[model samples]
Target: MGVVLAGGAGSRVGGADKGLLPLNGRPLVEHVVARLRPQCDRLLIVANRGLDDYADHAPAVHDETEGHAGPLAGLVAAFGFLACNRQALPRWLLTVPVDCPDPPRDLALRLHAALAADATACCAFARRTGKPQPLFAMYRVDDDPVEWRASARDALHEHGSAWRWHAALEAIGVGFDAPGDAFHNLNTPSDVDEYERAHAAS
Candidate 1:
């Protein structure tokens, strides 16, 4: 299953819903969905607001915790949605933040391979130029999701950092040879404008 983490507070982006913000004439989440769809069997979007808008792209699920807890909460929400719907747990849960308009095209393939090769790794995340990106990760889902969900919730309650939680999971980092700007995040309005201008010019 593929999940888009769009439930951020957007504190740096003038409180705007970054996922719903326009980039290249389309919502940021739309661009992410288009890139992730073909890589997975099913897609889900985790958003705190604009559910209807996000739903237009894929089945949108709200965060389990309120007040934009963070991406860890979004992970919990994804697991909860699957449990609530009685859906079979996918072998791997692939996730990417919505603000990252362009992620590695072979994200899932590389992460899956890394996890498959490492018997001790509970998950695998992308690392660009030695910088770990926990948001763009693939979590191994065991036969029962209870343990995984519990650990995620614990991490969410203790510390809201995705990297911290991923560390506890012994996640492997799969390096990508993509450009340094491949995972450029649109955190502020200026970032969005700059990206638009750069891409439009190219």
Candidate 2:
């Protein structure tokens, strides 16, 4: 399963929904869905607002946790939705933030390989230049959905950082030898403009 976290407050971008922000003549979420759709058997979007608009692209879910808690809240919501609907659960979940319009094409392949390499690792995320991109990650879901749900709740209440939650899962960072802007995420209008300029140049 692939989940796009579009339920953020977008505080950095003046509270505007980053996913709906225009980028290169299309909404940022459109680019993200385009990149992620091919990588998963099923794709879902988690958005607090614009549910109707997002639904046009893919099925959308709202964060179960209140106050737009974070990506973990989105994960919890997705877990619940899958539990109630799917006859069988997916083995893993690949998550990416809507702000990151251009995740690597081989994201699932590399992160899945990382978890396979480590028998005990429950999560794996993208790493570039030694920086962990926790949002672009693959989490072990087949092992114990209940356990992961509890862990996500604990993380949401105790420490809301995705990086910290993945750490608790004994996550591994899969290195990607890609350009510096490979994981670039739009946080502000300037970032949007910069990415658009780069995209046009490319």
**lDDT winner:** 1
lDDT of each: 0.88, 0.87
Q: Best candidate per TM-score, number?
A: 1
Which residue pairs come into collision in candidate 1? Answer: none
Question: Model 2, 97-128: lDDT tens per residue?
Answer: 99988899999999999888887888899999
Worst 10 residues of 1 by lDDT: 80-89
Candidate 1 stretches greater than 4 Å from native: none
lDDT of 1 by residue, 1-202 (tens): 8999999999998898999999999999999999898899999999899999999999997888879898999988887776666556687899999999888889999999998998788899999889998999998886656777778889999998889987877788888889755788889999999999998898
Task: Evaluate residue 168 in candidate 2 and report its C-alpha lDDT on the 0 to 100 scale.
Answer: 79
lDDT of 2 at 124: 94
